[model samples]
Target: MNKQAQAVVMLLFGGAIVRASLTDMYLRYVKESLRPFLIAAGLVLIAAAVMTLVHEVLRPKERAEEHDHGHDHGDGKPHREPWVAWLLILPVLGLLLVAPPALGSYAAGQSGTALSSQQISDYPPLPPGDPAKISVLDYASRAVFDKGVSLGDRTVRLTGFIASGPNGEPILARIILSCCAADGRPIKLGMSGNAPAGLANDSWVEVIGRYTDRTITDPVNEETIPYIEVETWTQIDPPKQQYE
Candidate 1:
């Protein structure tokens, strides 16, 4: 490519690096899986820029004798080695060696659906004890569509972080998000039985519970809302991302 075209490519590559480094969204969604490839692409772009610079600097002058022999200026550029392009491989290799983790606690305070409460009356009740275990997302989504009537007295297990409610009580909560943690809304479930066992905020837990659809007035907001009443709760390790 010509100097101008090479320069534009270099600019784009630099812009991508800046963008990836500045925003967590791209790292959360786009760069996680393709980290190695992105690193490789960055290195390649850097190499291209260096090679273009070298070629521009070392370009040889045309010979007068060659012109007499019917030789052309050949686009006024020297033949460049494609192997020099491999210099781009360095960044990618580094990324491949050290892929970063996904978005984490740093985004806990962001505003998003991951932390929002859902309408409890919308979900079907849990069916009587069955072997097929369901996920918290299924329960939450169902709660959004229909009240937990279909879950009737069935024991459902939910796993998530132990976030504090408006009150001093330890609530088993999980952040449900529309996109990344930035949009996460907190959903708190009321644990029944004995008070949560040695539970602490941000700790992970698996709670087996019967879904009770009842509205409890929020002391902070003074608004009555629905919540899942827990039957059993067990503490466990916190997952990488509290919200998926």
Candidate 2:
């Protein structure tokens, strides 16, 4: 592509990145801690594009003529940019219009929890609260690997979307990202003891429960999933950050 065309594309892409980072939209694709770095990268791209554009406009006519002649063939048509260069605008348009929705139950169902065989060290007891809020990943890890010993008798609140089990039974689940959505996987917890019934998949909810000894086997991966003896549950809006 010509330098002028390249600079315009760069400016659009960089502006999209900066615009996304300025709001919570970026959290849908990456971790909250990555916001600053994303903003910095966007700024760098914008600076580079601006510099290229300035340099192109200020070039002496003699130098421009000489450079063009050096590479120009005896063709009748003007040079055209590569078709692939236009594809870069797709993401820019998407970013400007609407960010993609966060991963949901379908992704959770396709994924299997590896924490069943994992050896998580004893986590400290939950802090004070009748139903102390806990992350779905943390709760699942403690229940499966640590035998729920750290959870004690305290009830904890877990928030996640509903995912169906082998028998079409409802279960609580959340996606866990190692770095970004590309490496994300779901951690699951089976619901027992007065578990909510007839809830649709991906209906975000806050489940109140304590760890239980009961376990369920995941048919897809043949991994064991731990249970929570649910005291109660209530439907709610999805959280601002969907992944753990």
Top lDDT model: 2
lDDT of prediction 1 = 0.53
Which residue pairs in model 2 clash with each other? none
Per-model TM-score, in order, reads 0.51, 0.90
In model 1, which regions exceed 4 Å deviation?
1-132, 195-197, 217-225
Whole-model lDDT per candidate: 0.53, 0.84
TM-score of candidate 1 versus the correct structure, residues matched by position: 0.51
- Which 10 consecutive residues of model 2 have the lowest summed lDDT? 65-74
Per-residue accuracy of model 2 over 126-189 as CA lDDT, tens digit each? 8778889889878887887778788988899989889987667898888888778888888888
Best by TM-score: 2
lDDT (C-alpha) at residue 42 in model 2: 98
lDDT for each residue of candidate 1 in 193-222, tens digit (9 for 90 to 100): 554766556777777766666544445444
Per-prediction CA RMSD (Å): 10.4, 2.5
